[model samples]
Target: MSSDVLVCQGISKSYGEGEQKEQVLSRVDLTFQKGQASVLIGPSGSGKTTLLSILGCLLAPSEGELIINSEAVNFKDKSSLTEVRRLKLGFIFQHAQLLPFLTIKENLVVFARNTGMQADDIEQRIQLLIERLQLVAMAPKFPSQLSGGQRQRVAIARALLHRPSIVLADEPTAALDWHNGQTVVELLLDQARVEQAVLVVVTHDVRMLPLFDRILAIENGIVQVKQNVK
Candidate 1:
């Protein structure tokens, strides 16, 4: 069996129509292996987020085929695409994007609930993930009560709550200071590896670039492999 977790071939995307149409991505081919951390670096408006969205099933490419863990996914149907996203992908945004009214525990459980997981085991898995992510003490706190780093940590725990096969992160460390940013990166790398999932991070920070297994650069709507220093 192939070890590829994500496979994209000749993917293309555009927005608008007619003469106003703008191509955001063009023929982007990529593949990510299980347990590997792939970092995508690019300038603003360079289609890094566009490509990530496509890979995460948030957006459909104009023409291409994507195979996730050997299963073909049609990005055309809205309902089916939503189901695929819920069942197969975990997303971590720049901000934690937690509900201010919900506690950390509630956020995690809510994720499990939406994924059709057993309600009886929600607490067990939530606690386990909180402990694993070193957020056990903050489980009872809401997003407003925690620091930026703590909130991001909770977000990561929530993302992993349902045990998705792939985690897609967008500027995960953009909101933190030096120490906290490094800490978050390390935590993400460790948990992603431990869970045996493919991690694709879209980041502008070069500080954390060395830690990734592979680095790809996006420019002019194209993605090219860059040398990994570490």
Candidate 2:
């Protein structure tokens, strides 16, 4: 089996039309292997989020292909795109985005159930993630009741619960303190490694850059590999 889990080929994204058209990404090419954690950094309007969105299948690139697990994504096929997201991708946003009415565990369960996990397996997975994320006590608490860091921890658990092949995070630590941010990133990296998932994080924090296996920097609609460890 191939180690490559996520591959972007000649990916390009633009907005508007003709003279009004604005290019956001230019023939960007990236390959993320299993168990690889990459941090993407760039200026505010450097198209970092645009590229991430394409990778997450939330948006279609104007010109290029996105392949996950060797299958080319069909942007025109809504059902297929939905399936790809549900079966192959996990996402963590800047905010925890947990359902306010549901308890932490319930939040995780909803997604697991949506992905067609069996009741027994869902229960087991939830238990394992709760313990691993040190979110045992918070599991029964509602999202509104938990601290920011605690909520983010639950978010991590929620994202990893289904064992998706690709994990994408967008400024996950943006709303937390440095200590909490560091802790959350560490936990995310550790869990992704355990799952052998391709982890891609978009951040403006240069401080957290070194924690990832590779650092991808975007400038003027182009992506440049700033660093790669091992």
Candidate 3:
């Protein structure tokens, strides 16, 4: 297996077709090392999210190869792609996307089941997630019962519940105010390190850039590492 947790080689994405096609990413190559936090920053419509989607196996690049968790990706095979996404990658979007009708614990169970986790000691796992994410009191509560930050925390816990090897977050703090954003960023950084999973976050906010191991700048379909703090 490769040492890198996620690899993107000559990746490119285009919308439309032929002369009408617009290229969003142009031959981008990116590799994320295990247990490292990589921050991707770019202006709006700069293809930051597009690249992230490719890296997370949520979208297939028009050209190039993406390897996640040392597995060579076969995008044409839906089952393989689905398996990789379920078993290896965890995603946290701008919204929590928690099931509104289910309780916090139930939401986690849904995630675990999709990830193919064994049923043994499921409650123990849920309790640990609750404690780790400081969501203990909200475990029995529904998504509607929590604040924005708390909901996002539950989302983060759900992402980590499967013990995925990598986490891809898209503007996780975009919806929160400054203080809440900072708190969520700190929690993500802390948990990613503790879980030893490769963490990639795409956002325009510069406030949290210093906390990342490296900052990847994306502009007009071009990507370059602006700083390597590692």
Task: Give Cα-based local distance difference scores for all models.
Answer: 0.88, 0.93, 0.88
Q: Clashes in each model (backbone N, CA, C under 3 Å)?
A: 0, 0, 0
lDDT by residue (tens digit), candidate 2, 1-230: 98999999999999999999999999999999999999999999999999999999999999999999999999999899999999899999999899999998889999999999999999999999999999998888999999888988898888888899999999999999999999999999999999999999998887888899999899989999866654
Alpha-carbon RMSD of each model? 1.2, 0.9, 1.4
Q: In model 1, what is the error at residue 224, expressed in angstroms?
A: 0.5
Range of the 10 consecutive residues with the lowest summed lDDT in candidate 2: 221-230
TM-score rank, highest first?
A: 2, 1, 3
* Model 1 error, position 193 (Å): 0.1
- Estimate TM-scores for all models: 0.96, 0.98, 0.96
What is the alpha-carbon lDDT of model 3 when measured against the actual structure?
A: 0.88
Model 2, runs deviating above 4 Å: none
Tens-digit lDDT string for candidate 1 (1-230): 88898999899999999999999989988888888899999999999999999998888899888889898788768898889889889989999899899988888888889999997778788878888888888988889999999988987887777888899999988999989988998899898999888999988889889999999899979999876766
- How many Å off is the CA of 226 in candidate 2? 2.7
Flag clash pairs in model 2: none
Model 2 scores a TM of 0.98
Model 3 Cα lDDT, one tens digit per residue, 1-230? 56698888899999999899998999888888888899999999999999988887878899999977666799888888888889898889898889999999899998898777778756677788789889989988999999989999998898888888999899999889989998998998898898889999998789889989999999889899866654
